[model samples]
Target: MHVEWRGRIVVDPELHHGEPCIRRTRIPVSVIISSLADGISEEELLEQYPKLTREDIRAALAYGAELLQPKSI
Candidate 1:
């Protein structure tokens, strides 16, 4: 089974140990976020992950931001 998040991100147990990744690619969201945090520019990221787009990067960021939000219980 395949699960999609933020349109461009996906989570599949068969892939990357179910870590959220870019749809159709095994690149995990955490890697993308970490790369950006480590001073890797968007251009560099694009070069490194050709399958990803600006929209995909933005979606990953949005996903990360949502995860950081406090849940209302």
Candidate 2:
């Protein structure tokens, strides 16, 4: 599952106070991650956020995973 999260996620200081969000949408990556963590299904997510796609959901997962990687000095 090699998802290109960079293209799906965006950080704009003018949007959501600079929170990382799905491109062209105000929904934060954290919200999507949290919803999934809380047992929300992909289909359910799509219904909840009609603006999001399956790829966007996957991208959110990928982005979150990338953040957990150990940073090098």
lDDT of 1 by residue, 5-73 (tens): 567988899999999999989889999999999999999999999999888888888888888989999
Question: All candidates: CA RMSD in angstroms?
Answer: 4.9, 0.9
Among residues 3 or more apart in sequence or in different chains, the pairs in candidate 2 whose N, CA or C atoms overlap within 3 Å are: none
Poorest lDDT segment (10 consecutive residues) of candidate 2: 1-10
lDDT per prediction? 0.88, 0.96
Backbone clashes in model 2: 0
Give the Å shift of residue 17 in candidate 2: 0.8
Q: lDDT by residue for model 2 over 39-61, one digit each (tens)?
A: 99999999999999999999999
Model 1, which residues run further than 4 Å from truth? 1-5
Show where candidate 2 strays beyond 4 Å: none
TM-score to true structure, per model: 0.90, 0.94
